[model samples]
Each structure stands twice: as C-alpha cells, then as structure tokens.
Target: MDVNTTTGLSAASALTGVEVVERKGAGHPDTLADGVAEAISRAYSRYCLKEFGANLHHNTDKTSLLGGAADVRFGHGELTAPIQVLVNGRITAALGDHTIPVADIVTTAARDYLARALPLLDTPRWVDVRPRLTQASSPGAVNAPDTAEREASRQRWFAPRSLDDLAERHRMFSNDSSAGVAYWPLGIGEQLAVGIEAHLTGEAFRTEHPYYGTDIKVMVVRHGVRVQLTACVPQIARETPDLDTYIARRAQARNLIAELAGTIAPEHHVTVCVNTRDVDTRPELYLTATGSSIESGDEGVVGRGNRANGLISMFRPWSAEGVSGKNPVYHVGKLYNLAAAEAARRLHEETGLDCAVALVSQSGRDLTDPWQAIVQTSGPNAILASRARRVIADVMEDLGTLREQLLDGKLATA
Candidate 1:
C-alpha cells in the first residue's frame, strides 16, 4: 500500500502493488516449475508450431519446476516480454514414463489458446527455459525446530521474487488517512458488500459483505476494503517459446493495462475470488505434511513450522534468482494486462458507467535480495487467490463507480 496521491477524502489515498514469492523443489515448488516449463515446451512444439509460425523447431523446457514461482504483476507496463520454459527428464517425477505434469501441460496449453484468443493480445517471448531436478521435500512451515532445522542445513533459502510490502499505502487508502476521490456507494446489488470475518475464525465482519466472486468473500470496512479471493492457483507450471502464435495472442491482450489504470481509485471497493483446481507439489524438498506456524519479521508472511516442506521463502523480495528470472517478469506482465482489460470491460458493461481505471495491489510480503538472511511466498494456489483478489477489486470498484455515474445521468433504466 504505497501512497501515490491524496484524494478529496484524506491524505491516505494510496495505490496498491502486489507481489508474492514461492520456492521450488520437493519441499518447495521448483518441481512444479520444472513440470510447467517442460509442458510448455512440449505443447509449443506440438500444437503451437506449424500454425502460429514455424520458427519453433524443437523446444526444451530448461526451467527447473522444482524451484518455485516468481513475481506477479497487474496493470500497466509491468511486463516487457514472454517467458522461456526449460525442461529435462529430471523435472518429471510423478510421471509414470508416459504421464506429463497436469498443471504444466494445461497451463502451457492455455498459453497456446491465449495466443489466438478473442480479445487478440500480444505476448512477449519466453526464451531460454531450463528445468532441473532435486531430492527435496515440500515447502511447509518456515520456522523449523531442532532436528528439522539441522536437516534444513542442506536446504537452500530463496526469497520472494514478485511480492512487495504495501502496508503503508493500504493503510492510507483503507482508512481514508490519505486524500481520496469521492465515492458514491451503490446498493449492495448482490454483487458487493462490506466488512470481514476474523482471520481463520470464519466470522463475517458484522455481516459486512463488500463483494463476492466465484470463490472468496469481500468487504470494505475499517475505512478500507477487505477481500479474500481464495482459489488454489494451480501449482502446475507451464511456459512456451515455440508457441509464437500464442505469444502473439498474448501480446494482443496487453492493451487493457492502460485502460484500467486510468479509472479505479484507492477506496470504496474490495473483492476476492479463487480457483484451486490444480496443485503442483514437490515432495523431495520437504515431503512431510506436518508442522506448526512460525511467525517472523514485519509485514511478511513467512511460513515456518515443520512438515518437511520448503514453503514460500520470506527472504528479501526481488532478491531470489527465480524471481528476477525473465520468464516470470513476462508472465506477471501478461496477467496484469489481461486483468486490466477485464476491469475496463466490467466498468462499461456492469454499470454502464464511463470512466478510466487502474489496479493497485501489494502482496502480503516483500522480496529481499542479497540472500544471506532468512527466506519468503506463493505462486499457483495461494497465488491465484491473490490475483483473483486484485482482479475482482479492480473490476468491482470500476463497476461501482460507473454505476454511480449512471445513476447521476438517469442512466439506471434497464
């Protein structure tokens, strides 16, 4: 929550920027990364080629799926290019010789679809993919005990690649401490609400429902918006450079970023959504599924406890190798653009209001580079939940604003 400007309401009208870090490998999530890269390569080689173009001769996903996911972006020139997935025999674990990683395969396939998708978009090229294998378990608790901690001596620490800390800005916009734009609330038309449930308590905030998506609840209370988009972002990783046609399609989607950033504000709306269908795991890193919660640092969600899992590294954001990697930057930019487009569409269609909008989000944690210290974050599962939150918030706020404008213009007729 970084305050960029003050609104009429107060000095707290700050925009948000979101980021998250997820490790790879068995204990972490690199295994999943490997699968995604290889899957993307294979799919690109097969379908994306001979159709989109023919520059794709043979593809090799060199991405070590077991490593983890990198940064995520939403709105504006966040991304500059496409991703490169690398693959090899090492990254493929659960496969019984013929089976490919489910998430990886489909994700890459999805990229292929987006290549020629309806909205027509442009996507950067994902080049130089590399995949590797490891014998780690899954990423679990961040706070390791004695024996487990000792065993972790061999375990490497990775930081958040894409996530950022925005408590300040979020605080300002949330409570109207910063100046904000005016707000004209719309009736909670079964689409939005306000308030929140205590974390893990399942208690709705005084029945204050701000908005709801296919999954997760939302509310705008305490002078700010609270949302929970809780869908499992499939851990199944995927990428493709061979799929130039799909890349072209992705590129087509880039336009929406600007459209949205021009509208929405820092207050008055919140939304959450999720989809936890696919999960990519790495048992080798920390396969055990048992551990306790270990809290650490300020403004950072470090998963510490146990269960042979590597979990999201709380290390510095943007400091991780994979996070700074090129493919992730491309992917983050790609999704941000897609979400922006959706926001614009919603502004016009839902409320019939005319206004520009922008999305501001901040991941729960921060990315610390220069390793050295402890670790950091989430990609697929929790990642999707995070993204959905951002996407829904942007869309809902714009819609709400648009609706208000329409009512003013007597445009409320069916």
Candidate 2:
C-alpha cells in the first residue's frame, strides 16, 4: 500500500485490488460486536473531525429478579459498554460466583475489547471514538425491581417499564456503515438510546422500505445514517460469555477483507455488515476473511506485491507490504502462499464461484491459528487470487443497488 508523503496513510492507489484479513478477539479488543457497532455509530456524529468516537453508560442499578423459573437480570445490562463497567458488587473475591461481580465482568470485557478496536476505529488520529461516562451516585442503589405483575410483589420494588426509568441508557444509529457503531446495550432501551443519540446528533440516517418491512434496509442522507444493529444475544447470554476470542479473530478477518477489497482500484468498494442471530451456525456475510496470501498489518494496511495468488495476481502490488526484514512469502502466510489459495481457487473452479467459501487469512498475533472464512459473499465474483480480485467482486455485486445509489450519489459528494 502507498503511504502519503509524511502522514504514512494508505494512498488512493493502495485502495486498488483487494485484501483479505482476519483479526481474532485475543488480538483486537474492540472486535466485540457491540464495540464495533458503537464505534461506527458514534463516528457518524461527533467524530466528524476524528477517525472514531465512543460513549458508554452503565446502570445496573435496575436489576430485575424474575420469578417462577424465569430468571432474567437486566441491571445496567450494558455492563459490556465500551470502557465503563459499573462495579455493583465489591470485588473482594475472585472471578467466580460473587467474586468478580456482574459489573466487573462487563467492565473488564469493555476495557479489553476497546484496547484492540480503538486502533481499527482509527480513533487516535485519522479516526476517533471518544468514550464519555455519565455521572451517577458512587454506588447507586441495588436498583432491582421485581416485575412479577402482582400487586403484592410490585409493592416492594420499582420496575423499569421504559428506558427512562432505568438508571442508565445509551443510543446509536448510522446510515454510513463505514462509520463505527455502539458496542453495548443489553436491551431495547439501550438500542433506542443509540437511535435517539443518532437522531439528536442529526447524524442518524432515517430509513425507507427497500423491499417491504425488511429490517435489513439502509438509508444515508444529508450528514446522517441509521442502522438497526442486532445482537447475537442467545450466544452472548450463554452460561459463560467468551466473546473476546471470537471477536479478535473476526477483527483480523474483517480487516483483511476490507483492505484487500478496497484495492480493486477505483472500483467503489461496498461494505455490508450482515448481522447474525446465530454467530455459531450463521457466519456473517462480509465477516469472513479470505482471498490471496498477502496479509495486512495492524489496521488492514498491506505491503506491495506480497499477494500474487489468484485474480489479485493480475493487479500490481495488490496486498500490504511485508516488514523490511521478513520473507515476503512468509509474511503473506502459508495459506495464501500455496495450499489455502489452491483450495480456495478449487472451489471457484468447481462452482464457477465460491458458493461455500472458506475464510482464509493469517494473523500475525498468532501463526498456529488461521481464521476460516464464513460462507457468504461480500460481492458477486469468486476467484479471489489477491486483494484486488476479492474486493472488485464484492463492490461490483455485493453492495445492494439502493446502497450503491446512496453512496454513489447521496453520499458521493458527502
């Protein structure tokens, strides 16, 4: 990728060709779905001058104890909000049981996730995602209200019917998918807050029907954008939440794909965030990292000519540059170097396009583990020989027509 004279930014030419990458949760802290969402949404507003921005609110004070086999707890359910985890219970103990406290778990997760995602969000320089904390009582009340719907049980507790009743709330929305999004919001209230924030900021793009009642509609007009960010709640709410590993790996892959795809050369890349209710069985559409052997550095930036595998082989300097001393081939990874590329190519040959694609990409943070591609198309074409091949395919076909119209026209000058 070409760098600007002094800023060292990826030049316009670097945008040519495609780059496929994978980032796991272990490596990137902000890859957490919630964090990524918040970053994009916030960037839509205040980060206009910065690369990224973020805001978090935790109100576990409104804990709820359901009765009769239904134990639902909605304390500051946004415990996982970026950078702010309310410690409802003192942490005199360890991680298990009452040791870590529900609040601590969320706080730790937010801190850890932000560490990695902040870089991708470009929050420091070209990007910014500032995090703000709303002032609250040092230790808010147990805020638990029983919603048993009985006059007897209702007597002792104050339940929250609307987000306002809760001690904390956060909101975000965006028409620009490239913009960052909000990361935490355990219930509808937080989602509403995100939406409200976007609306109030005058940055949340309103929506119209693309098909008909399809929640998957996108609209970006003026200096605004709005997207209904969904959550993999069931998985996220399992007995034990282990999203860090999954998120970082996903980050590595996403970075690789976006970088490589953008390399298609003035091809007008399109990014689609296909959220899944089932992260385990349903792989995200654009979430998979596959294509060519060439790899990217920390923020999806790649070296020159490192990706010479497939269709990208047709493009000049399709991937990110390898470090000065490292073997360029080795830098791209064994998968892209030979075997994986061959396997990826074979699928396209047999199916004319990779119907069930494998997510391919090497992660510098961990060599032994390479992220697999999810079976979904970022675009139409398949034979992703290099960064160029993959991105061109997606931009030409993957981006919905309406979306293309919006970006090409509505946001073209914007």
Candidate 3:
C-alpha cells in the first residue's frame, strides 16, 4: 500500500537527446511465441471454466518458436524444413478419472493463432507444433464439486484431508502471482512509431497492400524535431508478383508511413525507410512465404517481444516481466505491469502531468496490495503529487476490475 510521488522530467522532456522506439509486428517470431502462449492459456482457461467451474492452475508461458530454413525466390518460396514450434509449461490435466486433452488443445490453439497472425504462412505444411506440456497437480488438491460427486458415485473419490486443506486447495487453484507495468501519454516520437506500425499492420491497410506481411518491425529515432523511421516489412511471395512490383509496393508503403508520421506530428520532419537491408543491385529483398522471419532461422522466446504497451522504448523504464499466458487473476507479474500502466495513465489524466508508475508485489499476497508503488511526474506541484497518490490508491483498490479487463482481452502484453 506504500505510495510515493516526486517531480521529475516528463517522458517527452526526458528525450533531449536521441530517443529510440521499437515495435514488433504481430507476426514476428517473438510475437508469435507470445500469441501462441496466450492463446493456449485462454483456451485452457475457457475449458477449465466450462468443465470444472473454475480456471485450473496452469502457466503456459514457456512457448518458443525455432526458425526454419527456406529457399525463397522471387514470387515463390519453398520451405526447406518446417518451423519447430514448442509449447512448454504445466497445467492441471485431470479431475479424478477424467483426463484433459491438454496437448491437443494447446497444439490446436498454437496452430490457429499462428494462422491468424501470419496468414501467409502455411501452418499445416510449414509449422510443426510440439506440445511439451506436463500435468501440474498438488498432492492435496481437491476436485470440483461436480467432478468429486461423479467420482464418488463411481466409488473412486477420496475425502478431503481437513477444512484447512480445502481452503488451501481453493486458494491455490484460484490464481497465480505475477506483475505488470504500463506507462501512458506517449511522446510524439513514440506515438508516431506505434501509430505507423499499427497502421501498416491494420487489416484495412493490409487488405489494400496484400503483399505486406505480418512480420513488420518499425524503429523510430527522434533527434530534436527530426524523426526517422526504419521499417523491416516482409512481402509474401505469392502476393508480390515480381521483384519490381515488390519494390514499388515497398516505396508506396514507405511513403504512406511518412505521410502518417507527418500527421502525427506536423512540426516534425519525418523520413521513412522500408527494408533497409534490401539490395536491389543484387536483386535481394525481404521476401517470405509466410511473411514472418520464423521461416528463415530467427528464433523467438516468450518475454523477448514487446511489452504491455506494444512498443519497446529505450527512454522509458520497463519491467522484464512477461504478462502473457500467466493467470489473469493473481499473477503479480501480469497484474502489476497492467496496474502500473493504468496508474500512470490515470494519474496523468487527473493531474495533467506526465507520469511514470512502478509497482511491486510479493508472492501469496493480495494483488490489490503491492509491496511498493512509486509515481514520478514532471510537475512539482504538491497538488499533482497528492492527486497521483489518490489515483494509485484507487487503482490498487479496484483489482477486480483490472482482472476482468485482463480476462476480457482488453490488456495486451505482447
């Protein structure tokens, strides 16, 4: 419950020198890993709720994607080897005699997620999904009431050890401890970077530019009023008819992004470059069969991708916690990150001051009560500080609302 606030440089003022921001498109390998992990967790939670009336204890946060080799040519490409997708983690797999199809569910979730995220990737033909999930059941864990009664009718149920045991079981199955971090009121440069990236990946934009792949990367650097954006966008071989067409499309996309950046900050001079590594002299380009680097030996692991805000900012403080796939209820890693971001945004809105919020939570502690909560703002007024404290307190007190938002997919960590 400890809360503190102090005057400091705003996120925008702090960027007196070079400010850099990076965002990974949804189809990047690391993003793909995050997507699959979250998909499995959501799928598993839904299954558990329907079958057991509660979300079973599970953490599928160790998902990974190993890039595969491909022989990519102009307008065509062939996978030399299938991308190896490994979904690893633990989950409750049994309620008495009824065994849960954990592997089947996870694998299907992974495939479906990748298919949607990377539409050009032939998931069934180029992606090999391997489920390494293992059962996670405590010795004194109690089954759901319906499951217990069903087993009892079959003469296979066991009595609870004690009232304390039942309480402990309930607490253990309720949620996991995790933390989340967020910040708001993005600076002009950061906003431009994120906006441009989102615009390129947006469905409407992609529909017009069918060759544009999901594995897009946008990096923005701002020095004073000059903003530079470098985008690495892959083009699907099938959609792009030839090298010349790809070049034309890339130019069109770059110009569109530059125009969008100008709209984001009209005072800033903007420059946009797409696929800097491409060399037309050698006829080399950023081409892919699946529009993702996963088909070309770029490995991805959970937590290595974007943060809750969807962009990595070098000028901002960020936690190393990975929020996806963790239990949405009590996982401090996920909760604190989301809470921190919300706190910052709300504080800024109330006080009209740029703010940064950080929160820490201990294991087994109520998520609403954090070990420490810090709020820093560019404003030195005591009224702003007092308002920031009140905002933080209000956010911490409403943990249940945050939980619902998380479960409803309103908060994204990848």
Candidate 4:
C-alpha cells in the first residue's frame, strides 16, 4: 500500500472565516431513508447469516422516500395520500432451492423503522413499503471469458447454490473503487449543532414538548467565537391547537436550543433562531400531522443528508460514499469509512493532537488493506507520523469487529 504522512492544519484550526455545520434530526426525510435502508441491510444480513451461515451480497443503499400529501388544520391533520418508500437495490434473493422472503424482510423492516422514527404517524395507514430488489449482476460481469472459472464467479455474484459457492467466506475483497475520509475531534460548533438537533428530537424533549415534532434541523454558522444557530422544527398539529400555541412552541424551542448551546459550548456566544420562515401575517406555519415533513410531501433519498459522521462539516474533507445499506463484510465504502474514523479517533487519543485520515480502496484488493492511506496531523512532527501509522494499522486490523458492530446496528451510519 502507498502510505503518505504529512503535517498540516487540522479542520478545526483551519476554520479562519465563517464555518458552517449542519445536523439533520432523526425524523428528517433524508435521515428516514438512510435509517430505513440501514435497517433493511441489518435485517437481511442477520437473516442470511442465521439461515445460510453467511452474509449474502447486497447493496440496499439506493432507497428513497416520496412524501405523502397531507391536509392540516389547527388541531387536526391527516395524510391525504400515502407515503411511498422504494427499497431499491441488488440482492441475492435465493440460495440453492430456497427463496429468501425478500418482500417480508423489506416491508417488515420498513414498518418497524417507521413506527420508531415517526411515532405520531400510523405507518400501516399512511405509508406504503415497496421492495424493488433485483438479483442482477453488474453488466461488466457478462464480459468475462466463457470458462469454468467465469461460471463459478457468476454463480457467486447473486444466486449462489450453496455455502461453497460464496467466495467471500474464504477471503473478502473490495468490490468497488472508493475513498473514505474522516477527522478526529469535533469542533465546538459541530458539537452544538449535533446536540441541539438531538435534544429537540429526543424522547425527553418530546415528552415535555409534545407540540414540537421530530422533523428538526440545526445549522451552526460560526464567525470567530460568536455562533449563530438556526433550527427548523415542525410543530405537531394535534398538540398545537392554535396559532398562539404554535408561536409559543417555536419560541420555546428557540430558547431551549440557546440554553443547550450554552451548556455545550459556554465559551462561544450562540444566538438561536427557530422557523425563520414563520411570519405574523401568514396563517400557515411549519406544522405537521406526524411531526415530520414527510407527512407533507417532503421527499428523501439515502446519501443526501448526513455523511458517515453525524454532522456535516463544510470545511472538513468528506467522502461521497453512503455508508448505510452497504455490505458490512467487504464493501470498502462502508468498512473504509468506519476504519478511517476509528483510526483518526485512536490517533487523536494516542498523540493528543487532531488527526485526519483518508483511505482509498481499489477493487479486488484485500479488505484488510487499502491501496492508499494518508494521515495528516495538526502540527509538524515526524515522530507523530509513525505513531499515526501504527494507530491506523491497528484500526485496519480490527475490521472484523467493526463488521460485527455494523451488523448489530451498533455503529452510527449517517
């Protein structure tokens, strides 16, 4: 592998001008898509492992959610049209003579996730779960020579006859060319952004403020030590009886965010704003029936919201690969991102310095190694470079544990 170690300004230190960070709450449409896709992936992996003794090849990262139409009033609201969720991806639906219940798996997972994500919505009444899975291989697979080896490979691509037909069980290989980027030590602005969103969508907050919905978003813009925090959160129609209550709830949310920010970063002066679009003259508000914009025609797609890391930092290096719904066993897009993040965290712990890591994988390479590995430290020190490399090596070697964590839904993806 090609290893490069260098010294440079870390992402936090490089924040010279205005830095922007965003965090989407659990009920956001894009986050919903990501959560559902990941749920399906984990459910399918568990089923395949339990039934067939191996995880099947599948990439369910292409999931999408089309928002439903809703009619809302002061104290009542309902979905006029059902929301449509398309779980689209490739999967090995069959093994030998037994056909895996792909429909049951996808829909069950979708319903289970929706029930948890949007507690106010009746999933069975207002949501439609559609499984659009296929068992097709990549077009390039057909270009191989007409030999016995090619036949064996094709068998393992999607429709494996038995455990012997699964090649990854012996030795896992990277399936795509991709890169994973990660950095350690979340800045104060990042922490506040994430914390505000979590507090607004959390069960404790929701229990007290049932008028506030889960469809929440926090944006933090920092100029030096002063931070401006803006949030867009939906007010539940059932809990909000009138315009006054809605306005009051919005103000309450704003104050809560400001208080939470102070707790998270007392050094930074944070100004909070909520529902900037709301106007005194307008009767309409950022209200929802189910506490989510998805109940009112706001669509969502996987990979369009948060990155593998929860917060989206504008100044930090980011990878386009969506970690959720990816195969945890061999897909470098998922494994490498998780690895790079863990490596950065370990390096920071070991050296007491901010760390950044980038790992690139070539198709067909061993999963334990990457084609290129780059490590950067906040300060200039050659000795720290060696220490960073060792920390990264340890992370790469522990990918097996990472895979298990991923299958168990223990890791945060998106």
Candidate 5:
C-alpha cells in the first residue's frame, strides 16, 4: 500500500468566493435510475448470498429510464404512453446447470422501486421494466489453455460453479481501475443544497404538504456572503385544486425553504426561488399527476445526477465512478467512494481541520490496499499528518463491512 499524507492545503481552505452545489431528489429521473439499479443489485446479491453463500459477479449500473407522454392538467392527469425502464448490465445468470431467475428478480425490483419512488403513479399501468442482462465476457478477455489456474478463472469470470471458484471468498480484489475522492466539512452552499432538497422531499414535509412532489431539485449558489437558492418543486395535480391553490402553495413552500436555509447558514444572506420557469398569465407551472417529471417525458440515466455523497458540489473535486449498482463485495468504485467519505469525516473530526482524501485502485489489486492514497489537510502540521495516516488505515481496514451498510440502505448513493 502506498500512502502520501500532506498538510497546508491552502487552496482547499475556507469556503469563500463563488461556489455552486446541486441535489436531485429521490423521484428525479436520474435518481430513479440509480435507485432501481441499486435495488436490483441488492436483491440479486441477497438471493445469491442466501442461496449460494457468496455474492457472484455482477454489475447492473447501466440502468436508464425513457420519459412517457402524458396529458397533465391542474387537477387531473393521465399518462398517454408508458415509461420504459431499460435495465442493462452483466450478471451471473446460471451456475453450472442451475439457472437463476434474473429477469424476474430485475423486473420485480424495478417495479417495486418505482412504486415507492412515485407514489401517485400506477407503476404497473404506466411503467415497463425491460431487463437486458447478459453473462458474456468482455471483448478483451482471452481464453487461455486449460490449466489448473486458468480453470478457476474461467469458472468465476462470469459464472461460478461453486464457492471454490470465487476468489473473493478468499480475498477481495478490485474489479476495475478507478478513483474515489472526498472532502470533509461541507461548505455552507453544499449544506443548503442538500438540506433544502432533503427537507422538501422528506416525509414530514410530504405529510404537511401532500401537494408537493418527490421530484425536487435544489441549487445553491454562494458568492461572498450572499447566497441564492433556486428550487424546482413538483406539485401533485390531484392534490392541488387549481392554479390559485398551486400559486399559494408554492409561495408557502418557498417561504418555508427560505426559513430553513436561514437556519442552515445563518452567516449568509440566502434567497429562495421556487419554479422559476412558472408564468401566471400562461398558467404554466410545475404541476404533474405524479410528483416526478418522468410522467411527462423527462428522460433519466444513472450516473447523471448526484454523487454517492448526495450533493453535486461544483467547487470540489469528484470522481466519474458511479457507485449505485456495482457489486459491493469487490467493486472498488463503490467501496472506495464510501470509504473515502468516511475517512475524510473521521480525519476532520479527529484533527479539527478540513481534509480531503483520494484513493486510486488498480484492477486486481487488494481491496483494502489501494494503488495510492493521498491525504491533504487544511494546514501544515506533522502531528495531523501522522493522525491522518492512522485514520485512513483504520478506515481502509473496515472497508469489508461497508457491504452490510449498503445492503441495509444506510449509505445514500444519490
């Protein structure tokens, strides 16, 4: 393992100047894709682990949703065309002669996830789950001569005959060459960006304002001491009586969010704007039968929304690796991103300094031991550097247990 610990990270200091952060709610199309893909992976993993005692090789991170046509109005709406969800990925469908019901599992998971994500929509009537799973190897894969060592690789590459063929049962290895990055102590803009969306889409807010939809987007932009928050909150057509009621409800929601922002970042001057594209004369507003824009042809794909941390911070560095549907056992893309954030938070708490952690993993490398780890602190301090190393090492050692948390839905991918 190679670890580089440094201090005096001045460029990563105070959250001054202009910063932008955004968050997509659970019902957003992209987030819906992420949730559906992750649900399928978790379901498949649970079935395999219980049936075969090990999670086989699989990566279902390529799920996407195509928007459907709808005739929405102020009080009632109907989906004119069904939304199609393309579930594309690779999975171990058969173990020797025994076949796994991959299609049933994927379809069930997608439908159940969509039902929960969009409560107002009739999932069976308006949504279609299409599974596109395969067990084929990559084009670059080479078939070596039949040998003792090569036999095991061939069995477990996509289909495992038994636990003996699974190398991860003995040692976890990276599945790809990827990087994960994280920073501790979120800025005010970041806090508001994530907080506003959470508050709007939360259960308490939903109960109080049943008209508000789950498909909400919050963008926070901060320059100097002033902050501007723009939020697009969907209103359920059935719950909302008319345009007058919608306008009043929008105002009330906006006021509440502005108050919440004030409480979240008291030092900054925050202004809240809801549904900026709305026009009173045209009577055009963000209204829908389902709280999500997917009802009206808003296409969404995985990896296009928030990161694993749930906030898209434009001012900070991030990785392109999407963590939603990758295998939790050996997929460093998911494990390392969660670990990096955990390590950064722990380092900041222990050292009282803004810290950033970047982990790079090479394909087939040890899961806990990355190819390189760089730790940067806010200021120069030898003591802090040593502590960061210890904290990072401890966090890496616990990477194996993240699978359980992810399975339990403790980590938010979006």
Candidate 6:
C-alpha cells in the first residue's frame, strides 16, 4: 500500500476559528467504569497466567455505574443509598478441576480501583459492588456429542488444538471486533485542556488541596491564539467549612489554573473559569461526600469517557472504541488503538508534521498486521514523508510488545 503523505491543516493551524475540546477526569463515572473494567481485566489476566499458564478468553468491557443519591448541606453530606456498581462480562472461572475466584477477584479489584481513583470517596461506606460475570463456554462445548465414538472422530479430524489455535478461533467467532484510531501532535489548545485537568486532579495538587475531589473536567475553547478553559471541579464537603470557604477555594483553584496555563503557552492569552454553576446566593455548589458526581445521580457507562490518549479532540479524527477490558493478547480493539497512538506520535516526531493513523484489523488475523493501515500527514514533503513511512513501519514491527506492556499494566488504557 502506498503511504499517503498529503497533509491537511495542522491542529495548530486549524485553531484559527473557535475550536472546543473536552476531557473527563479520572473520577468521572464513565472514566470510573473504564478504569474498573481495565483493572478487572488485568487482575483476571494475572490470575489466569498464574494458574492456567495463559490468559483466558474474557471481555469485561460492559461495566456500568448507577449514580447514588446524596443530601448535601453546608459543611457535610450524606449518602441516602450506596452507589451501585455492576460488572458484567464473561471469564474463565475454572481450569480443569481448579476453580478460580472470579467474582472475588473482580470485586476486590473494583473496590481497590475506586479507592485509588477517588480517594475522597468512602468506598466501603458509599459504594456497593456487584459482580455479574459468567464463564464463557466454547462455541460447540454445549452441543458437542458426548459419545466416545464422536469424540474420537472429532479428534481425528481436528487433532490437538494448540493455545494459539484456540485464541485465534475465539477472536474469529467473537462479536466484539473493532478498529482503533489515533492522531498525534496535539494542538496547543488540546494540550492545555488535558494538562490543566491533569494538574488540578493530579497527586501533587490533591495533596496540597485535599478539598479538591477527583471528579473534575476541563473544556478548552481556542480562537486563534486565545485559549479559554472551563473546569468543573467538585469540592469535598468535609474539607470545606462553609459556602464562603468553598468559594475562596474555587477562586484559588481558578487563579492557579490561569498561572499554569500561562506557563504552558505563554504566547496565548488564557482565561480560566472554575465551577461556573456555583451560585453563592442560592448556596448551590458542586460539593460531594465522596468527591465524585456518581454520588449525585450522574450515571456512567463504560467507553463513554476519554480515549486512550486522555483527551476528546473535536479538531482531530477520533475513535469511540473503548480499549479497556478487551483481551490483552490478540484483541485488535485494544492493541490497534495503542499501536496507532504510538505510530502517530513517532511519525510526527520523525517527520515534524502533524500525523494521523487509522488501523483496522480483521477478525482472527495476526495482531501485528492490520487490514487497512493509513498514515496521513499534514504536508506533502517527500523527505519527511519517507521518514514517516519508516517510523510507521517500525511501530508496526513493535506491535507484539504492546500485549506485554498492556498485560503488565504499564500502559494506561483509560
């Protein structure tokens, strides 16, 4: 296939008019679902590897979060009902005669993930986790003839199935095949939006300002060189003494964001707004007992949050496929997304041009080989184009390593 080096307007150049980008914080319900699903998948993979010598066939991507009700006052709040967390999927629960604690493992992983992601949330007190997982049977397991003669005939024709054969068969017959898309060289606006959100909700910021909740969002609107940031941050009720204190904290956060934004892009004029919905007169605030919107009737479903790169870019091509909770080994939905991102990043670095990559994989094909792989660049420079092709080829060659990184938890899928 020929590499198309025809470039479009770079993300930076495309920001001449008003462009908007959004990012969901780590504690947001949809993000929570993604995190929980990935955590469960990782734990299950580890368990299967330790006991069964291979990762099991499981797709735990259907997790959901049902928001809980809460009553908030000036300085405190109470949860009327615990947040309902349901994990739905299929897994290998038994290997030969040994039974794997699938539910227990998933439940523990979910609770631990919530505790880590939303430190302000009293997970045990406000979160109720339920596992609705089942063992995934092979395609013909239930209908296969039980007679010894039939079994002998089947073996004679099929012979002994290897692990790779089983994995390929599972991939071929699975209904969850998907393509992964990513682009590189994020625009200044995109970077600022994602960066500001990360700074505000990051560990250092959280440690300094304990009242700031994990459920924070950042929206960026850029017109030419001017950038505007709107952030929705939840304040923990216990840490806030009253409405006045909350207002003061919000002001401080806003100022800090402006200061940080200036450092990020000094040439651009940046404006910051924090929690615009807050009205002191009405005493309406974004306060939470657990520091998450999930306690306030905001439902979240998996794959509805940010992509693997952590920013939802409207100016660039994006994919809605959720990479988390899919199989780590050969699941193209997961591998191709991560691969495309890396490929785009490398191509941009090597060629100094804005790059976009789309990788599509057919069911049961080799993970490294995509059915349709396209590398689009922002300009038509032959020398740079050649370099971009080399970078993409190198990235494709490294696709096999992605599975290891994913299974080891070294990559962030959410």
Candidate 1 Cα errors over 4 Å, as ranges: 1-11, 14-83, 87-92, 95-414
Top-down lDDT ranking: 4, 5, 6, 3, 1, 2
TM-score of each: 0.19, 0.17, 0.88, 0.96, 0.95, 0.89
Off by over 4 Å in 6: 1-5, 13-18, 136-165, 169-177, 382-390
Per lDDT, the best of the predicted structures is 4
Q: Give candidate 5's error at residue 353 in angstroms.
A: 0.6
Tens digit per residue, CA lDDT, model 5, 1-414: 677887765342244777788999888999999999899999999888888878888999998999898788877877899999998989999776778899998988898999988877788898898888888765445656663255447435687766777777776778778999998888878888878888888888888888889899999888877899999988988888788999999998899999999898888899889999999789888988889899888988888999989988887878887788999988888888889999989988987888789989998888888898888877666334567668878988887578888887777777
Candidate 2 Cα outliers beyond 4 Å, as residue runs:
1-33, 36-101, 119-263, 266-350, 354-414
- Score each candidate by Cα lDDT: 0.24, 0.24, 0.75, 0.85, 0.84, 0.77
State each candidate's clash count. Answer: 154, 88, 15, 0, 3, 3
Deviation in Å, model 4, residue 351 alpha carbon: 0.7
- When summed lDDT is taken over every stretch of 10 residues in candidate 6, the lowest stretch is 151-160
Q: Model 4 scores what on Cα lDDT?
A: 0.85
lDDT of 5: 0.84
How would you encode candidate 1's per-residue C-alpha lDDT over 1-414 as one tens digit per residue? 221211122111222322122222111123224233323444543332233322111222233321111222111111123333334322222211233343455455434432322011132242223344332422443554652333212122111111111122122121111111111112221112211111111224212311110111222222233322222111101222123422332232222211221223234343333222212231111001110000000011111210011122121111111211112111222122223334434433544332222333233222111001110011121212233344345543443343233223222110
TM-score of 2: 0.17
